[model samples]
Structures are given as C-alpha cells and as structure tokens.
Target: MESFNEYHIDPKEFTFLKSFQDNWQAIRDEFIHFIKQASNEDLKLVYDILGPKSKTIKTKGDAKYSAFGILFQGMFIEKYIQVHQIKYPDYGAEEASQKALVLREKYFPSLAKLIEKVNFNDDEIIRNVYFGTFHPGLDIKLHVNYNPHTNRGYLGLIVPEGDVAMKICHEQLYWHEGKFLVLDHSYPHCPHNYTNYDRTVLVVDFFKPDKPREEVIQFENEQVTQRMQENPYSLGVFGKSDRAKVEDFIKYGFTHQLEWDKAL
Candidate 1:
C-alpha cells in the first residue's frame, strides 16, 4: 500500500470549472453504469440485515449525535466475558475477514460480486466491514480517514427518499441506491445527510491482494491496538456497566477517536 501522503489531492485542483469541464461527466457516466449493474434484491438484503430500526452505536467522531454501525472488525459480542456479572462477546480484528466472508456469501452475494470485480486481489482479506447509518440532518465534520495501509469502498444501499445529499471531499454527490463509490480515506472528506430518512451504506476496508498476508495482519494489529488505546468504548471492549458511560460520552463531548492516532 502507498503512504497516506500519496492519496492527498489538493482541494485547489478541484475547481468548479474543472469538475464541470473534465471530471463531472466521467463520474456521472461511471455511476450510471454501476447503477445499471446493481441488483435491487441485493439492496433489500442489506436493508434486511440492518432492520427497519437499527440499534445505534457510538463512533470515534461526533459522538454527540446518533450513529449506528454493525462492525465486522475491531469489535464483537462475546458470550463468555463477564463484566459486572454480565457476559458479552469480545469483539476484535481477529477472524473478522472470515466473518465478513460468511456474511457476503450468505446475505449479500450480489454486493460481494460487485466488490470482487473491482478488488482484483485474489488473496485479499476484509480488514473492516461496517454498516453505518446516519439520520436526517446529520452533519459530519471534514476529517481524513487516514488509513493509507488499506483500501476503502462505500456502496450506497439506502439513501434519503426525498431531497438529500452526501459529499466526499469537495464533490457533492447524491446517493443513489445500489451505487458504489471507491474512496481513499487518507484524503479529507465529510458526510452530510439532509433528508427525512436515515442514510445507510456498506463501508469496506480490505488489504490489497498484492501485499503479503503477514504484512496485512501486522497492519491490522497496529491499527486495532491504536484504536483500543484511544477509544476502548468505541470498540465495545468494556464491561456491561460501562454501556451507560459510553452513551453519555456520545451524547455529550468525548475525545475524538483519531486525534492522536494519525500516521505522522
């Protein structure tokens, strides 16, 4: 994988005129082609996994607002670990790739096929599979994902039914159902949901197949360890009694997860 610095695109280079004249049509055409290939049944499968009203989780950013996530890596529900006499599954990065494979094969085959086509690495492993949901009027600050160690992809499963929009970097894009967007998280970006309904997407991070498995695992370990140190609650690596504390932190202001973990 390339260094995070390699992915940074200067905002000045993305002028309105340049977009209109050079890039907008290409983006539009690619999205149109992707949508044409998308399956409605696959989209419904994702929604079913998420449910009509999904349980929300506290993320590293904007904890004051509600955000929901079903994580395949960096967290789990352990049935044996007891915190205050209550047992919860221990979640972490281990076996996350396998778990994601099970989910893709069983529930989201079509979506999986779409991802496989773009990610040509035959030995690639899913480093993270997250289903994130944000409600209407939610605004996320501009922040870089900053994980140059892995590749990231986002597939829009459900978007607002009415007038709503989402932005990546300086490009404001309308989320169309079943459309896919590949992104370099190391670059600065933000998301804004302006609609009456919730916005949901399948976000994936995976090791590119070209990298050796040992190197990939090492990267995953470093990333997971950093996350655990910075925000244990975000990883759900806490006792049952800590749930309220986590919720409170999310409701108010807590430490932002990645403030100290940037790749310097």
Candidate 2:
C-alpha cells in the first residue's frame, strides 16, 4: 500500500522480519541439511525441477533462475503441507488449495510457528516459502521476473550464508547471511555467487491484497476453470515427478562449485 522504489525496498517497514532475523541460526542449519540430503532420507525435502520457469517454465534448465515454488506464483510445495493436512483436518478443508492455509507449518516446528505467527498477526496473507539455491559463475543468477501482482511482501530473500550479491539496476547489493533483501521484481536484477560455495536463500513470498489471499486464489481459479472449460489446454498442473532432475541439477551446481573452490 505504501509507495517504494520500483527496484528496492526498505526492511524497516516490515516488522515481521525480526522473527526471521532472530531465528537465522536455526534456519540456516535446516537449509544446509536439506541441500545435503542424500536419497533414501525422509526428513529432507529434495527440490524438484522448478518448472514453468522464465522460458520452458516447466523444464529444469529454465528453473535455475528465480526463487521457485513454493513457486514464483506462490504455489505450495506439497511434501511438508501434506503432513499438516493430515495432522490438522480443517487446515484448508473449506478453502482453495493454492492459498487456503491461514497458517502453513513446514519441516521445523519452530519455523512453522514463525510462519503461523506472521500470518496470524495479519488478517490474511498468501505466504509461500521456498528454498532457492544458486551455484558459482553466472549460472546461479537470482533473476526475479517483474511481477505486477505483488505488494509489501513482494519477495523477501534472505541469503542464509554465502558470498553472493545481486546486481540490480547497476547496483551491486551484497547479501548478508540472516539479513533481508526485500524488493520489487519489477526492476531486472542479477545475483551472482562470487565464491564457489552455493548461494542458497530462504525465499518468502507473502501476497497481500485488499481481499484475503484465499479469496484472491479462489477468484483466479474460477476464472481459469471457465477458460479451461472452453479450451482443454488452457491450463495444466505441473507434476512432481522430477526428483532425479532436481538431484542432477544440484549435482551439477554443487560439483562445479566444488571444482571452482579447488581451482581457487
């Protein structure tokens, strides 16, 4: 609702950020665990090929850029939430799946509680969380597409820990571990991992509109359903069968990162 620079945002305007800043240590620890998760493990969430990216969007190559779902459009990743749906029957029972949860609980109870608090305080906000990662070179670029349908919480990116800085509008905004980079994606930006280490960010997308997030989602779905009724291919759900693709992408990035470190 407040006016801001089309390119950047001030952190002070957001009070909820303190919770995230305070819990940085725990957050980073969990993120590291997920990225290092090997197959055959149950606790970790392996990032699937973030599809429907800038180009292919539904393909792996195009997924490398942007903070994925938890998506570019606030799509909830299922593994964690499925647990909630089963644990709490009424979580989103009467609402739309896309933006129904009044509170979304994730892997870590503490983290889940934090998310709940943020939403609980606000009347209703469509908040989506995702772990976004980048490798060395220009490949791990943080390029958020200019999204007009965003507000105060346009995109809150916290670089858990890494030598990564985003280049936006000719400005190099270096990210500090635990600090927040709240900005509008309207301005094109490029974030590069200067070091060989992976630059991973805990991305939080809170879509705040005049109407509640669930209502916003319901309206959009209805509109799309109408269109789909006329044209069968107008809409399609992205599948979650890309674990191998996700691992391969991580392997490539992490392997190259290790190589870069060795070269240095």
TM-score against native, each model: 0.48, 0.56
Model 1 segments beyond 4 Å from truth?
1-71, 74-121, 161-163, 209-213, 236-264
Candidate 1 least-lDDT 10 residues: 79-88
lDDT tens readout by residue for model 1, 1-264: 322233433223222112222333343343334335547864443333222121222233442233222333322212111111221143333343334344345444444344344333433355444456677677765444545556565556666677555444334555555554555555545567667677766555655444677876786666655554454433421112222333444422322333334523
Report the error of model 1 at residue 160, Å: 2.1
- RMSD of each predicted structure: 12.0, 11.4
RMSD of 2: 11.4
Worst 10 residues of 2 by lDDT: 234-243
Estimate the overall C-alpha local distance difference test score of candidate 2.
0.46
Model 1 vs. true fold: TM: 0.48
For model 2, the superposed segments whose C-alpha errors exceed 4 Å read 1-4, 37-45, 49-76, 79-106, 140-144, 151-163, 208-264
lDDT by residue (1-264, candidate 2, tens digit) is: 543365567666666767777787787665555445534332212222221222212322333443333322233434323322312233342232332232223334465666667667854353455556665543433333423334323222334355567655545565667677776553444566556555666666555343466665675455434433443221212112211244445654565577678889
State residue 30's C-alpha deviation in candidate 2, in Å: 1.6
**Model 1: per-residue Cα lDDT at residue 42:** 40
The best candidate in terms of lDDT: 2
Q: Report residue 4 deviation for candidate 1 (angstroms).
A: 18
